[model samples]
Target chain A: DAGVTQSPTHLIKTRGQQVTLRCSPKSGHDTVSWYQQALGQGPQFIFQYYEEEERQRGNFPDRFSGHQFPNYSSELNVNALLLGDSALYLCASSLATGQGWFLGEQFFGPGTRLTVL
Target chain B: AQRVTQPEKLLSVFKGAPVELKCNYSYSGSPELFWYVQYSRQRLQLLLRHISRESIKGFTADLNKGETSFHLKKPFAQEEDSAMYYCALSPLGSGGSNYKLTFGKGTLLTVNP
Candidate 1:
């Protein structure tokens, strides 16, 4: 089975611009989560989606938003990107809810490397 | 607030040496613990979870609820084992909150010949 897949392997944006990153959940998976990973740092949760609705969100600001499609694919949108947004955006997928067997077994993608200029 | 802690940013040791990576977490509820590993140019993958009590690639992590710790250990380090390790805790849902995982800063391990 294909693991989580993310688009545009790399992205570049300017300050004040908006960016959208895409992710396709693994086959048979219905949950998707977004994370931001800075260099040399672990990933920070952004939000989680299930049943085509955002079921949970991290401590991120309103500038960061996401959408979950019926197919379990996801999109992460960041408005008014800042220079600090220059980091890797990771997309993970699992087969169940946050309390399921894969609670901590999030399957990650190669990640979309975002660089905010 | 739930938090995960990885004390070492970097660790280096010769091949065949025993390796240990320390992790601590802070959460009032019964949190689930996990260890994830990322090798060079590879996606982050789950190394193991606390509930399973199983070892992967010779690595094992035991969760100690009393001490709020889960340390990853391997009897012998292999050069291929070099990678970044992250400790994470999934805080149990309570009231109206959905569960979410908080990861530590991560520790990079280097296994040399």
Candidate 2:
């Protein structure tokens, strides 16, 4: 099923530069979420997209944004990146069951390591 | 506001010993809790969730509402069990959306031989 797949296994960008990370959700899944995991820390939710609209967001600023395509693929864009933005970006996909937000298991990708210099 | 807390960052145990990773949370409403594990060089995966009351890989977690805690435990630890564990909570979302998860910093479990 290819599960979930993310792009550019690794990336290097300078401060103030912008970066976009892509994710393809598992087949048949309708929702995609983005998270940021700093070293030695659990992933922090950036936002979740469903039905081509952002369903929810975390405390992160607008500098971090995302989009979900009709095919369920997603992208996370960061503007004017700071060194603090350097971290492992993870993409997760789940089915948007009518009952609850996270009713089923979320399949995560291998993650893209972003290093802002 | 919702938050998940894992009290320990690193927990080391000998093979075959009992292991317990503590987690606590703060939320006004009911919470759907889950335990996620990440092995070396591998993507994160769900170990189990409190709602299902099912055990995975010999690991189990019980949610104690009175204590506001959901701790993951295993009676016999194995070296393969060494990994980072995260506690997550799913709260209700506004405007007909489900809230994004709130995750703890995580606990690193090392089952040494």
Candidate 2 ranges with C-alpha deviation above 4 Å:
A99-103, B92-99
Top model number, TM-score: 2
- Candidate 1: lDDT over CA atoms? 0.87
Error of 1 at B4 (Å): 0.9
Q: After superposition, how far is residue A44 of candidate 2 from its true place, in Å?
A: 0.6
Worst 10 residues of 2 chain B by lDDT: B91-100
Pairs that collide, model 1: none
Model 2, native contacts kept:
0.62
User: Per-residue alpha-carbon lDDT of model 1 for B11-103, expressed as tens digits?
Assistant: 999999999999999998878788999999899898998877899999999998889999999999999999999999886544212337789
Report lDDT per candidate.
0.87, 0.90
- Which model scores highest in DockQ? 2
- Tell me the tens digit of each residue's lDDT in model 1 across A1-117: 778999989999999999999999888878889999998788999999988888778889999999998888999999999999889999988766345333435688989999988
C-alpha RMSD by candidate, in order: 2.6, 2.1
Report residue B52 deviation for candidate 1 (angstroms): 0.7
- Note the chain A TM-score of all models in turn: 0.92, 0.96
